[model samples]
Target: MMDTMFLKAALAVYFVSVLGYVTSIYVRRVMVAKVSTWIFFLAFLCHTISFIFRYLETGHTPVISIYETLSFFAWAMAGVYLAFQPKTKTRVLGAFVSPVTFLLMIAASKGLEGYVSIPEVLKSNLVPLHVILSVTGEALFALASFAGAMYLIQEGLIKNKKVSGFSRMLPSLSDLDRINHFCLMWGFPLLTLGVLVGSLWARTAWGSHWQWDPKQVWTLVAWVFYALLLHQRLAIGWKGHKAAFLSLLAFAILLVSLVAINLFFVTAHSFI
Candidate 1:
């Protein structure tokens, strides 16, 4: 109950942050965006507190249900974006990030009354490690996609000779590409490790290293997709538009697969 209360509080604060970010973009005020970042941080702190309370109540990581998964994913998105702020010039990127986080929080709210019991197979400590690592990696990819989307918008404006005031408000194309590169470099390895850990857990729980379940198969597909993107990025010296486009493509496929797997197909991972 306390967790729920805190979650509601976080959601409210996140909404305000979203409004602040959008307002900053429209008004072209860096100061407002900076203030929004602080508000977003406050919301993240509340979200963190909510998770702690949920863990205390659940006696495990609170990622066992659709409600928890969406909440955790939203938290990861906000955390990853905030983490990047100090090292990068991405303050305006919150215009993209906040809305996505708010939507996730809203979706999470819809499932709040439908919390499912964790299956015995998911009780292993690996659940937290696998879920956290994988979800965080996915969050990074989400950031990459956002950056790529921004890059595309900025690129289009530049190419069309439509460099207006709004285009000027966006982060530099080079900076967006760098964020894309950084996220790809880091997200792939984290996701690989997460898959390996999940496989180990699967071996113990289901007596196999790999299951041909739709979820597993699709996850592998997504992994290989990113792996290829990373390989192209490093080996072939891909950057800028090409890299940004592929990152958006990969993330799009991954997002579609994730929803399809969880909603349309039955699998070991459907507990979420």
Candidate 2:
């Protein structure tokens, strides 16, 4: 239970990092951005330590509860950005990224009161694998959406003939577009695999391969949307504005499904 302290501790550090990122954006200071990067690294380390404690106590991946899932999603997102950092000039992107992770962490903090009791159904190993891959894929889609949002902002500024200060700070359109494409290329397959594994787990837990659970249906909806996006990208060579718009639209649908359906619907897939 004491390890839960680490989760709180990580939340505090992440808040400070988010502030730093905001400041970096306001001042347009590269040094502040650099400092923010290290702070984010420290926050990520705290989150990792927190996860280690949770895993030690739970004897499973620490994504069973809504709190844990939010934590896991934020951590996976930060880790993905860090992994992509060296290859991209996305340091400024942290202004966008930190807020998303921080918001998830904040939502997660409300439930860190104590150890969460795992449901007997969640004891299945498939549950953890499904959670891990599925959340990671979702997290990647989040990043792609973030990048696409930035791309549109930059593109709009260019089209409107406005050479603003922050526009100079934003990454090139080519870079953001490439990141979106790469994320989709990778996120689609990972999500597909996640759905497949979840099917296997559903068979084990419910003795049926398909159910009309709102959560499951929404997840399938997200999968199909991503699949269509991928098909357009590969076959029709869609990129730039239309592709970015579709990516954002897909993420919006996924968000509605994950949040709205999970909260209001009487679905068997509701874990929160």
Candidate 3:
């Protein structure tokens, strides 16, 4: 019952956040941006409280079920936006970013009535830590992907000698590229930690660390791909569209790992 109420509240907050971003898109005044920021803050506060209530109701980390995973995804997405906006000063990205958060929150709200029942084998502290850090890292990568997509689009506009309007709203190409690079640098380590912890947990729970399960294999693939990107960025000083293209490819692989493995693959890790 409390979870249901929290879900409803989360949905409301998601809607308001989306509305605030939409308002930001049309309002040119500084006051409007400030106002939008406040609206986003309010929504974030509500979201936090809703998650807290969910935690209380579940008596554990609120990540046991697919519904809860979606909720966490929403939380991580908004957390990234809040953490990055001040640094990037890219209000225009909010117009795109907020909606994704809202959509995930809404999806989370859809299946909130189920009890969070962890599998007997998954009842360990490591599982929660792995999920939280992994989702948080993935959310950061998701934001980077959004920035990369925008960079590509804006770069295209520049190539075609088109500018102004939304094109003008974006930051310099170099700024987008820099931000994506920073996100990748920070996100990769966290993802690595999550993978390590998950492997440790697998060892304790199943007597094996690397089972080559679809999720595990795909996650390692993602880590390897990012590792290559980092190597190129360091050894070759890769940046600009080259780095952005790799970021885009990494995100595609992540989506496949997140969605395809769970939906189509028959494995213990297919928890979607």
Candidate 4:
């Protein structure tokens, strides 16, 4: 109940922050964006508190249900964005990030009834490591897609010579590209490690490292796709529009597959 209260508080603050960021974009006001970033940080703090309380209440990692998974994914997205702000000129990115965070929180809110009992197999210590790494990596991929989408918008505006005050508010193409590059550089390895850890857990619990379950199969597919994308990025000199387009494409496929796998088929990952 306490965690629910904190989650609701965070959601309300996230909504406000989303409004602030969107307002900053239209108003072309840097100060408004800065204030919105601070507001977003406050929301992140509230989300962190909520997660901690949920973990305490559940007596395990709070990622056992769809509600908790969405909550943690949103939290990871916020954290990843905030972490990048200090190192990059990404203040305007909150305009893209906040709306997604708010939507995820809204989805999470809808699924917040009933406590999920953790299965005995999921009680292993590796569960937290695997989930955190995989989810955080996915959060990074989400950011990369956001940046890619923004990059396309900025590119279109520039290419068509549609110079306007609104266009000026966006981050530079180079900056967006760098963010994409950074996320891919790190996200791939984290996701790879997550899959490896998950396999180890499978061995411990299911007596096999590879089950060929639909979730596992789809995850491998996503991993391979990103792996190739990352290779193209690092070795084949992929950047700019081509890289941005591929990033968006990859994430779109992954997102669609994730939803389809969860909804249309049964898998070990159905707990989320």
C-alpha TM-score for every candidate: 0.96, 0.97, 0.93, 0.95
* Per-residue lDDT of 188 in model 2: 83
lDDT of 3 by residue, 1-272 (tens): 76677567767766776776677667655556566666676777777877787778778888767778878887888878888888888877777777888888777787777675667887789988998989988988888888888889889889888896667767789889878888898889889998898889988987998898887788788888889988898899998887888888888898888878877888787443
Q: What is the lDDT of residue 54 in candidate 3?
A: 74
Model 4 stretches astray by more than 4 angstroms: none
lDDT per residue (tens digit) for residues 20-96 in model 4? 99998888889999999999999999999988988888788887676778888899999999998989878998998
Q: Which candidate should be chosen as best, given TM-score against the real structure?
A: 2
Better of 1 and 3 by lDDT: 1
Model 3 stretches astray by more than 4 angstroms: 26-31
Overall lDDT per candidate, in order of appearance: 0.88, 0.86, 0.80, 0.88
- Model 1 / residue 183 / CA error / Å: 0.8
Clash pairs for candidate 1: none
Clashing pairs in 4: none
How accurate locally is residue 141 in candidate 2, as Cα lDDT from 0 to 100?
A: 95
Candidates 1 and 3 compared: the better one by TM-score is 1
Over the stretch 1-272, how does candidate 1's per-residue lDDT look in tens digits? 78888898999999999999999988888899999999999999999999998888878888767678888989998998998898987898899999999999999978765246778778888978988888888889999999999999999999999897568988899999999999988888988898899889889988998989888787788788889889999999888998899999889877866677788777876654
Global fold similarity of model 4 (TM-score): 0.95
Per-residue lDDT tens digits for candidate 2, residues 1-272, read 75578777878888888899889888988889889988888888888998998788768788888778888999999998888977887798888888888899989888877776777888888888888898899999999999999999999988888867668888899999999998888888887888888999999899998898888888888788888999999999998998898899899988887788867878888754
